[model samples]
Target: MTFAEITTKRGDASDGMATGPLGRAHVRADGPAKITGRATYALEHAVADALHCVIVQSTIGAGRVVSIDKSDAEASPGVHLVLDAGNSLPLVPKADFFGNLPPGDTFVPFATEIRHNGELVAAVVADTVEQARAAADRLHITYEEAPVVATFADPRAGDGNPVEAMSKTWGEAEQALAEAPVSIEVRYETPREYNVPIEPHGLIAHWEADDRLTIHEPSQWIDGMANQFATWFGIPFENVRVVSPYIGGGFGSKGQALPHSAVAATAARMLGRPVKLAVTRPQTFTAHGGRPATWQTLKIGASEDGRIVAIDHRGANETAAAANFVETLGVVTSMMYAVPNFRSRQTIVPVNTVVPGAFRAPGKNPSAFALESAMDELAIALGMDPVELRRRNEPDVDPENGKPWSSRRLLACYDAGAAAFGWSKRNPEPRSMRNGRQLVGWGMAVGTHPVYSSPGEAMVRVLANGRVEVLSSAIDMGTGTYTILAQTAADALGVPVERVEVKLGDSRLPRAPVAGGSQLANLMVGAVHKTALAAREDLIALGLSDPNSPLQNQANTLIIEDGMIGPPRGPAIPLGDLLTATGRDALEVTRDTLPEKERTAEERLSMFTSLAGMERGPGIPKSRHSFCAHFVEVLVDEDFGTVRVSRVVSAVDAGRLYNPKLADSQFKGGIIMGIGMALLEEGITDPRNGRILNANLADYLIATNADIPAIETISVGEPDYDATPLGGKAVGEVAIVGMAAAIANAVHHAAGKRIRDLPITMEKLL
Candidate 1:
């Protein structure tokens, strides 16, 4: 395999020409397939004589299973097998740090002990889906219920220790607060939230003979899934094959291989037949994971001039006793602004509930709401403009580690958003703006998220027909990944975008990281860029070595464009003709963009210095984060306590825009989710037994088209060449970071009510 490396540094003139289809607004290449129903999601795959499986969940939150009666279910019509702890295949415990597993209890299949309600207890396999579901419902199980700590308010919830990595302090914030002229302390609470991607979790497993296994599932990380399946089944990694060409949506929940996947595979091997499992929407709430609820306290101290002098943020979040996943909500404040004295800490609260996982922006979303809303309250105390107060507190460098920013354009975003939003015309007083029996108010907040790059590999092949194929294992979770990769290849090869095809979502292809953390674009694009460059070099070598070539020794003066190779200003020959003359069918090159393992000591130190205060290492001197500003206008009905957002304008400085149309769509989608976070979405749990009360869409609320407002997104400036080859930063998470805060601020401005809790429901307002 040939390798080409791309080191992150200042880009040159060739970078400009390679920006061919980058900024252009192109439609998603996978859109037609999706809308026309040609794309195959996980459960959509059809296999002949496939058995269906339905899992039975425990009714008790905490206890030990005493008795299981499966005779009734096994005797039902079309039933194949009933797998319980006594009959199910033995499985190994999850290894530490595998598939992002926290340091706590591992998920064991068909375990006799129950840690929470809805824990998988048994699996029923039948000839048809209906039979499997019916049989599963017929199974009778009994358990010994134990006293449970089911809520965040329970006295036992605070038994866990603090997360040391997330705790940081610069100076004495208490002293600064005591001496400041103005100070405000506020607490904010957010409810648990679910991912709820359109397509629920599903998987199909087939065992060929006894050593080989194949799975069709929607996973954001196929490579990791393959490794996990291999380890669990005691098979070689090469014998386990995972295929996931198209994922409906993940939002981080589908990134790992859950417990049900193991059950489906185990059942298939036992029966010597293919088995399919489709997790129902209601089951998704407990079977997979969701974001944990958070309680945050923020204290700020400011001078008379509205400049922040001290800040302290602390968060307590609920996690399942089975997993040690703590929401580090306070970390977002470390890079948000400049404060001389700052402190942040995170403490986990263990409760007998479903294990929490990452949802969209993860810790940043809830923390931003707390931090920005507290800033709004502080502005009110100081009698200063909210936007002006934020601008005055913008840090010249990262406040925690005294590191310079790779690219800090948050002020630019604020200026652009304020200008576009017409912020100067707004009245300062709350309840002063009105529209036909409704109160109108405007609010704005800052958004920031970390930028990171992981190792990945890609392969580029130039065929005899002058077509290009770029291959990787990256998943396209309806985020326009396919379209962006196509554009990147087209630009690099100097060919039409349509002539380039991108093949992804298969572990057989070159390896790539999971499509989470907003790192997919940067990683994949860098790999593709290096692969294409290497292929170009191979083509030039082949052309120069052939005596029949147009100009034998003019390689130094040759120009490759539009699939043609020729002298600087002479007759050109098609790449296919040159390949035919050289007796070659196609040319292929592979490149791997590994982490900075091979860099010199100074280079590594410099790289770490840029990522200081992010837990990367010590002695780092700079920080890299994407920034955005969300401005919103809301209409409040004082009579009914109803709040409706009428308009939103989001200005972002996330390096460069890969495709403005798709980027705008991502921004709107994230903002819509933010609106849901602010005014709608909440996952309720019954305190009596620790069961999720709102497990289905009918009970759990999300924003609909009727509830959304007119959203506009703006890009602040040119690319940040220091970020990546494409000069773009991560855009997926930042759009929603500060959205809830902005909406809550607007609500306070209109109604003169400071609702610290999330979902600012009518009941709370009234």
Candidate 2:
């Protein structure tokens, strides 16, 4: 399917060609509002007669509630109502994975069953947040505790159904491993991690009538939330509206409509007043989704020359018993390198914990940590440079399915990043390079993420005043979606970006896919491109039909530039003049853009069949993925076991960059998060009670400004037209996928101790 070609020649001198908005650096459009504190988040939404709600949670991870006594709480001053399971409205049951509802049990306030620690058991609504918190603390609750498995190592964790794709084999990996000249078997583990977005989960729900509801939420998927709310309340989908114009961050946590949203909405309808509920930071640890802890065993066999012959990866991840969301840990192993005999498995261990969901890069993050580290270990055993080892195994096509990459410049990324990070000067011997008391070590790793795009709709309108407006329901999540959309519209419509206004984050706008999986920019921008083309064509048609127009019948000769419509050699007239002559206030067009159905169908079939451990067919089909490479320099204190990242250089091949500034920001953000994952961040749980031990910011460690060092991001190659009209793939997730592996590899080079577990803490090194 060919789209309207919108080209930006590198050195064009036309008045409309102002350096082309693509591949340029620009300040974020929302920067002023954000810095000045004028931006309103979900919890900041104000409504008349809005009440505050505080949820009361269960102390036990698994249990049945005996009784809830709310007498003192209900009688407290300023308390409006105390609601429990017996009094609160019943909600529809949650569906399977990727459902509209959150990935957990349905919201049953004060329910008999407590599925996990910190499960909401009741709620108190009052005149203010303080009063609600005060009253909620006064409620008395009792529970009948039940035995629970809190970790993947527990024998009972294997009671759930085995994930079908957890175990698969393409050839006789065992025999190949035994015959190989060199082999290594290693184990790696990563602790559970939380998606601690700066803004906690919050919702402000208002019911205009019994059937009409409006909710302000920090939701990454407003459409999904609207659908879930409508279904739960038995109302028309159109009657439920979600507004989330600004979100501090999501990182995959706020994408679903959690139980709290329904509880708040139900309370608002019952009281005939708006209710605002914001989960405290502590509640976010257990209430919202997180990355599950994983344990992996990797067995790799290589020839004497460092060519891998057989690869085996087996892993298990913790998950809530109610959720079937298995992290795709083994999926990356099949695509990373060229190996004839390969086997991979990912087991889902049911543990008493919060349901695990997609944290940025999800499966690929932990998988890369295991696979890439193993590659380094194999490189060491084979006495070869790590980079050369990877180069030797680089597949001309996808190893698993024999598919040609739409665009894979992973090799180029390594080349560019290695040169920038001075990888040539590194010593192969461990603990050899040092800077005084700190051991200096350099490491590199390759990163990749599947290119994902979904159908999306967008509306474009050219007003009588010659201003253009692009509308969609996509979210920003601080990733600069608004800025990029404006750039796309400005470039497509031949207007200054300042004159093009982009509106988003409302369910009433054109439909858009969820703003996760790094797909929102490509999907929404493609829709806008199509919409702008339709609107431009409509303007030309209007000018040709207008009697007052000079080129009334020369539609083919017309050129639209800088809001002016005219023939290339004739007098030009403002677009407003043409609209005025046509007696129209605005020309509007809406378009829905979908991925190529045949290609999508083929890819889906291949993915599912491969997951089922079936044999792949012959021939090299088209494959799509974003690639990246990270070169990290870490300074490890030989005596104290303190590891500090000194420098990082990342080269990415994500196709065309709409805004280099925003892209660099995203790269840096991902790298910072990766540093946290490798050195400091871990969700600690109390084994005795299955409760999060350190849920607050003060206790839980993330990479702060003081922890970050110099980070350099380089964009590689031209835009890939085969991937999307914008010629871009996802950059949001890939940067972090291989980061931890790189850092861990550097630690091995510095300390000679190969710690396979994450957060490479001092205790382990000591």
Candidate 3:
């Protein structure tokens, strides 16, 4: 029922609060409810008198609507509204390029487009989903099909103009690479990656009036949706409400605006009713955008002393017909390693494919695979340990700019991670480490993600009954935002966790940055901190004004803690006593926090432009990168060619491990995703036609009940307090970064083949 309601007791609360009471730490804030299957997800919601809507997607990859034969659907019992390309109204117009879709890797949807497959060509709103689906099948539509380009293999095919552009750059390119002493070059590519958040994108919309719309959807953003809907529909920001109590997962899929949300809202408006539209599992691929595949060529040169001399990385990939979105694959080389002569370019071509968007790490995973793979190759060429080679070439400042890091311990991370992972225990020779039928190789890679956090506001109301409700617009996309916010409020208000009631996922409460860039804690902490302080001041003021209460004269000399206010050296009386004495209700406070604007402004002005939009570690004296060394043990049957990851040890440093249990779980999830990416994950395309072959789950295999290994993740870092209030960088992306490489390296060690490509298919070994 609640964290306090859990009956299992381990010990006492002396060890500074963890999971359950005392030393028990919940793997996640909402772990109990999730495991018990009591948590409510979007599609599980049941609103009063809500109608159902189902989308009918186009089978062809590219096409234009010729005719909509919807008579059969309209005539069906309980069928209400049918939306197709002809009658649809976009939340954002076709001409205006602005709409919230999460920052970076920009793409538009429903803008004079039939860009990709599974698009919502038509949708029928009916009394029930089953009725809607049945009715939809009866209606027929004609299409004038256009030739599709679903794969990146062809460079010459696209819609409108050929789209290509590098997001950012630096240094003289052709001149330096031609002059290097030793050089190496290779090509790297990665296929499409879906977030595969168990909760498919969907929305329930209730339009009480044309001006008032309430939405219950699975989202990582509540305030984001509020602002977006407010701006898009020209309605007052306060009129639109969003609610999400629990989210199965987001990864990147559930961030912001989608066409289905608009569809549900439109359905509610068309009929004076509430409408629910949850995408079918398979429809998520075409209706929602995902990480597109990428191809990169890296040419690196180094001196005899293990110093990097030059690097040239050029890349290209396909985006959707609606918009060209390119992942900056070469951004890391300019900043990750110390290289003077480095130049890179990223070109994105608009294909008749689904628009590429954010996956877990977005551009970083594929980029790291190529960059780290080449680094390992360089280590082999130099006859040096890969760990030592990276250590030897560390930068004194962020290479992208000459600026300092806010806080950096990459060297410490490498040294500590290597030692912990037992890097010295393994043989450097690829085929040396062996256990009867399996070869084991250990590999390490460095990953750096920005420590980004924005501003947030929180409202704290102390009720007459001594209960406190802290309201925030921050939501938990299965990352424990709810518990963390409650914890922060409890600690601040000097109340027990049970007494602190947290209200989240409501835009009517307060504004917060979308839960992307790993900034939830950073964005929320400031508001919670200030609001708590204000509540304390209010309590103190109340005590001073009244003379009858024990705290009246003592307010100036007293401190408040655990709902008590009294002298620092003596027993403090409960706040409820003071309220009882005065016959008053309770204290209330609200505060809005803007991130130290000066800090954001300064970073913007001082950041390196040559590295293309990526922030150089500003304010630190050394090059900043988060590091992790993965140790994977694999069991491969010589006959089957299927290598199973038996065990994995990942040592990482993203700064502090906030909730060790939660942090560990995050790493474990990363390891599993990494295993899938390394061994089984790939979106296959048919060679005959550009259609995606394994678009469904049954065709594309993933790590499931049987494949997960016993993963042990050890985090190393004293904490980077200067980075943020909680002292953590983006921990979510880095684990998956070098993860695929480590698993690949292990596979190579086992099979004696260097398979550089991902989803290292068994055919390569067979």
Candidate 4:
């Protein structure tokens, strides 16, 4: 209910314009709480008489549980209960956040059959977490092993099923490629990557009654998961309450209800005691999904002048047999350039592994790696500068659907990024530029992600004490969502940010869409604006109707500025005074809003089935997308095969800057993740048994402080009115798109070796 003190820098407002703290950089309202350890994350919520639950996992990759001997664990001291497939309560299968049956729903926990390794076999509840873990270890389990198809490369795992929805061909790509003067054909592969958030996945389930359930879990989509949980327990949706005030990080992993949560809730109801379950860091690998492994074969044909002629891309990603959550790689490939002939086919390879979920950029990230790397190869085939090649193929309209862009400044991004990164000083010849014994190289790639806004709701209340409260269910995944939403509400209500209190991450708050795909800002901002506007109007009406009001009978030109309501060029009365005179304690308004335009049936279906945003719909003549260009510098050791990212300069065109400081952090964070993708991070799975070898942080390498270098982010664009009322696009995912490709291209320029596969490792280079 409380936020840290907000720091704001205010400027003088004009007579008609209210220059509140909307675009200015303000300190985060939750900074003090987080730094001082006052912010409560999911597992940190303590409940009285709460028993700890530990899940026993199946050892075999793919198998059927023959028998589970839980008598020893049940008899252990401090053990409350030991529940397995034999004694588990029946739960309903519910749809996931995207309206599809995820593995958590399709494959019930404690079931006899196991789809993959680490499948939940039993749940042990005890007085303490240590006791639960000890009891879980005492349980003996036997499994009948089955042949496992671990990955797409396995011959047993046949060619994956074609994702018919993602397959598309506009022109004769084969014929165009055959006749083109310059063509390049290559294959790229991105390995599985895990989301290693600072805080692991955890949940506290307290069942007040058989019909009533309350869950305290970290979530990105509170409303979506609350409904899913209600369905699972066969309880009234209104009876289920989900509270998540803060999340360390989600990155799409916490967007839906996992099987572990359901098991904990069931345990709580059976024991008549609250249950707390925290997935260990090692268990997180198989407990939730991660970025799936993908293989893409790309063929690009270009003219002598460096214009792209044709693009043929066939992509496939690994998925769990129980869940058909495939990455649609064609979305980014079809629209990136102005190719006359373009063809794409996406497939999902069902393997005995954990179900794949959305990563930061999801399908778009690997797709960008394939497409942009191919573009760089195409540039090499035509002997053209990569930047110039992209410029030559820049499209006036979207090649996939023939729609104009809301605002595309890709060329401008390239210019700005190149200038900032000193692109002009680079030598064109491979391995020609060097610093001492190390080779120096410069590389660049274009980045783009669709702008999306879902239907959202917000409640705004203006109290007579000159205080404002903005309430929503949308959660911030360390993306500055709280700060940005507060700024938006304060700007619209003509109040200082310090007086505004923002409440979020609770299912009981006004409904909101999932805070993924970088869509929350546009979604909640509009809702907050509308609700604030309504409240402002109510205050103005109260002032105009009051007989003693100084602004009586001035409804025609009444305006609110600096917490004051009056005529545009005249003296104003304080909003608190109007409320005091009217004997009203507060003015409250709740607004449920849709996107700027109505979504088409197709768009709505896409939203439910896929994480993709609106592509073509009514009242949307333009294709709304954010664009950026990343210029990277790299140094390669000739003998040790070590690659280091020296510096990076990324210029972005994500429309108006809401919070420059936050945006810069987002951009640099993504670049650091890109650095990891290029040289460090990889999820190693044993193909023999489908077991993740590097599940723990000690083995799973990510970019550390020593790995990161100087990164500069420059914003370049005006307000895009066609996108949203706030005039801003998605910045979260766009910064990471095409980033890996930029680094790979730089490696090729430095070492004269085109390592097409991802994570340009030392052995691969050697």
Top-scoring candidate (TM-score): 4
TM-score versus the correct structure, for each prediction = 0.94, 0.93, 0.90, 0.95
Q: What's each prediction's clash count?
A: 4, 1, 7, 0
lDDT tens per residue, model 1, 21-112: 55666777877778889888878888788999998888888888998999999999999999988888876555422224533344457758
Question: All models: lDDT?
Answer: 0.82, 0.82, 0.69, 0.84
* Candidate with more favorable, higher TM-score: 1 or 4: 4
RMSD of 2: 4.9
The sequence of per-residue lDDT tens digits that candidate 3 reaches over residues 165-227 is: 343345765666677666678887777777777777888988878899888888777766655
TM-score, cand. 1: 0.94
Q: On a 0 to 100 scale, what is the lDDT of residue 520 in model 2? A: 80
lDDT score, candidate 3, position 246: 82
What would the C-alpha RMSD of candidate 3 be, to one decimal place? 4.7
- Residues 1-766, candidate 4, lDDT per residue (tens digit)? 3433876533432112225667667667777788899998978887899999998777888989998888889888899999887877777877665456544443355757888888878889999999999989999888899988888889899888999978889889999999999998899999999988888988999988779889999998887788778878788767888999889988779988788988898899889999999999999999988899899999898889987889899999998887788787867888888989988898899999878888888888899999888888888888888998998889999988888899998888988999988898888789999999899988888778888767778899888887789999888878887887888888888877777889999888887778888888877888888888888877777777777666888656578877777888878877777777777788889986744346675453234323443334655788989988999999999999999999999999988767777877888888888889989888887877788889999999989999999999998866888887788888888998899999999999999999888889988987
CA RMSD per model (angstroms): 5.0, 4.9, 4.7, 3.2
**lDDT against true structure, model 4:** 0.84
Candidate 1 residue pairs in backbone clash: 403-621, 609-620, 609-621, 610-622
**TM-score, prediction 3:** 0.90
lDDT of 3 at 122: 80
> Clashing pairs in model 3?
19-24, 19-25, 19-26, 396-622, 404-619, 404-620, 405-620
* 1 against 3, candidate with superior TM-score: 1
